[model samples]
Structure formats: structure tokens, C-alpha cells
Target: MRLEPDVILANRLADAAGEVIRPYFRQLTSVEAKPDRSPVTAADTAAEEVMRRILKQDRPADGVIGEELGFERLGAGRIWVLDPIDGTRAFIAGRPIFGTLIALVVDGQPVLGVIDQPISGERWIGQIGSWPSTTLNGRRVQVRPCRALAEAHLATTSPMLFSRSGHAAFARIARASRDTILGGDCHNYAMLASGQLDLVMEEGLKVHDWAALVPVVAGAGGVMTDWRGQPLRLGAMGAVLAAGDARVHAEALERI
Candidate 1:
């Protein structure tokens, strides 16, 4: 399939994001608290501002939805979803696994997506329908097959996101999985796309958090959906389940 303009633009968006984020990585300067009690760094706002400026210049009619700066022109058919840093805690803690996410959604479905790790100098790019495979640092990547949950390797941003009563469901999948990784954010999904990881389950995610990763996993021969097997929508339930194998996805969905 041919590459669309949006796919090419997503690359520029990643480049724009990297410029603002790399300087703040491990600097931890002037961290502020949001109403939700989540930490926000100057890098977050700066990176998103770069995206907004570039998009406003290049795709003036397109909409933008950003984690740090909020939304603008969301009703437009084509909207850019931006998450300057998907793992702020890890970023402030000096981890390079945190990533910048950019997704171009067309009519509520993500048509193009990118996960960029500026400090690590790695990126995973994916586009739905335009290509059936994903690219990691320009190298094509695909997910490996895992037929059962018992053989799966799972990853999540954090297990603590689960409530005390919700632990039972999470524990069931944890027991079935061979290993569970904590706190990799979108980088974990990039690993899943590149065949290094088998599954990732997450909760309390916003559109900017998961939109870019959805196409990355789907294009890499993985299945991504909500716990009940529903398609993820903007501002939908935060629960997300993704697996390299469909059978494993089905198996885990039953437990989630």
C-alpha cells in the first residue's frame, strides 16, 4: 500500500515532539501538580506546543487533542492526538523508556500513529489499511505468535492503577502470564509490536495515551481492544487489552 500524507506528517510531529522533550529528560525542573494529582513537567507543555504550532501551520483545518494543552477543533474529521510524554514519572526518574505519542485520527478512527523515544533514539510507526506491518526505526517489525495466555508475557504501565477490589481480575491474568512487566507505557506496546513482548493491559488511559499505540499494535499483527472486545474510542473507558495473538487476547479478555 502507498503511504499517505498523514503518515509522513506523523514523522514530522515526532521530530517536533523530540526537540522539546529531550532537553527536559532527567532534568526534572519545575514539576507541577495537575488537578488529578498527576505530575506535569515543562517539557510536556513545550512539546505539545511544538506540535500545535507545526500542525496549525501545516494542517490548519485539522483538529488537535493534546494531553497537556487540551483540545481544539475536535469536531474536524481529521484530528491530531498528542501525548508529549506517556510516562512522566519514569521520565522524571531518568528512564528513557518514556515516549512521545502522535496519532492522526480520521472520523474517530486512528489512521496514522507514531511512538517516538527521543532519548533512546527509537521509534515505531504504524498506519491502518495503508500497511499491514509496522516499522521500528525504519526496520519492519511483526509480533510473534503465542497461542495461550499461560505462555504469554504481559506488560502494563502500573498494576497499582487497579482498585483493591479490581485486583482479583488482574491477578488472574498475572497468574496465567509467564511474566508481567510494570511501567513501560507506550514503549511496552512498541516492544509488543516488535515481537519482544506478548501482551499489555492498561487502565485509566486517555485518547492521547492509547490512540497512537493502537495502530502500532494492530499493524504489527496484534489485536487491541477494550476488556470486553470493544473498539477503543476517544474518551471511552480507560481499560485497554492488547495481545500479539488473537487466541491469547480472547483468553485474557475472559479473565479481565
Candidate 2:
């Protein structure tokens, strides 16, 4: 299928943000803690600024909510959600797992999403009412079929976000799954959408963190929900569990 206009725009924004991030990918002089103690680097601010500018230029009427700059309500019934570098800690440490995230939210629901890994030169895009697909240098890819949670591979953006109950739930699910991996931020969700990975469970997310991922996973014929099995709506509180297929997601949620 020809890419939808919004999806194309999302990819363009991802590429533009990647251009801003690539030069500093491995050349960070130092990293410091934000007031909240989360890691931050020059790359994050610069890339976000680049994306913000592109959105303002191309969709001047739409609102924008970015991790670094917070929110701008433009009253246009559309919003661009951004996480310029989803794993800044990993990026600053010289890991190639970081990626840029963008989502077009209409009336508080994400309709278009993109995740780009500049170091890997891969982009994943998903839109409402369309099949999710990945592009490695612009070639299409689909998610793999893993129908059972016991057969699925699992990943989490962070292990520490789990509570005692949450951790136990994760452990139970992990024990049932084929394998578990860690620490890819938005990349893990992209992998699940592309069928390279089966499931990713994460807690303590800001809307910016998961908004771009929801459409990407869902468009790939997968399912994404809060732990309660509710559809993932923007601004919802609690953990997120995304799976490559509904059956696998149901089974995994049962174990959790």
C-alpha cells in the first residue's frame, strides 16, 4: 500500500530528527541528571527542538507535546507527541538502542506513529485503519506470528518500574514466555510491531513514552493494553503490555 500522507510526514519527521541526533550519537561529552534524576544530554534537547520546528512548520495548526518542551495546545483537534531520544541513558552510554519517537494524536487518540533508530537506519510506521509495517531503508516488513504466550519472546523497557506485585506478575509471565530481554525503549516496541519480538511490558510511562508505540504495535496486527486489558488511551495511568497477537496478549495477561 502507498504510505498515507500522515505516515509519510511522520517518517520525514523521524528522518529529520535522526539527522539532528546522528552527529552526536556517540560523541556526547557528558551526561547529567534532570531535576527528576532521569538522564539528559545535549542530543535530546537538540533533536526535540528539530522535531518541534518541523511540526510547527508543517502542521502549524496542530498542538505539540514533547518530552523536553512539554505541551502546546493549538486547538486544532490534532497533536504531535514526541520523545526525541527515547533512551537517553542508553544513548549517552554509547549503546545503539535509542530511537526517536513521534505520534500524531487526533482528539487524544494516536492515529499515526513512527519510531526511527538512526544508528540502525531503520524506521517503523503505523497508522490507524492500516496494517503496521517496518521499513529498513524503505522496505516493508511484518511482525512474526507467535500465537501463544508460552511461545512468545518478552521484553521490558525497565525492570525497576515494577512493584512487588507488578514484579511478581512480570516474573510469572516471563517464566511462561520463551525468553526475556531488556532495555530497548521504543526499539523493543518497534521490534514487536515488526515481528522480530513478540511482547514488551512496561510500567510508569508518560503518554509521550507510549503514544507512538500504540499504533505501531496495533497496526502490525498486534494488541496493546494496560495491565487491566483496557485499550491504551492517551493520558491513561498505569503499566502497558503490548503483544504481537491478541491470543498471545490474552495468555500473557492471564499469567500476569
Report the C-alpha lDDT of model 2 over 161-237, residue by residue, as the tens digit.
78888899999998989999988888898888777899899888888899888888877778888998987766687
Q: Write the per-residue lDDT of candidate 1 for residues 1-256, one digit (tens) a residue.
A: 3447777788888898898888777777588999999999999988999989989999999999999998999899888999999899888899899999999888888767899999989999987774465899889999999989989999988888876645677888999899988889899999999999999988778899899988898988888998789987676777889898999999998887
**Regions of model 1 farther than 4 Å from truth:** 1-3
Worst 10 residues of 2 by lDDT: 132-141
Clashing pairs in 1: none
Error of 1 at 172 (Å): 0.8
Question: Worst lDDT window (10 residues) for model 1?
Answer: 1-10
Question: Which residue pairs show backbone clashes in model 2?
Answer: 132-219, 143-195, 144-195
lDDT (C-alpha, whole model) for all candidates = 0.87, 0.83
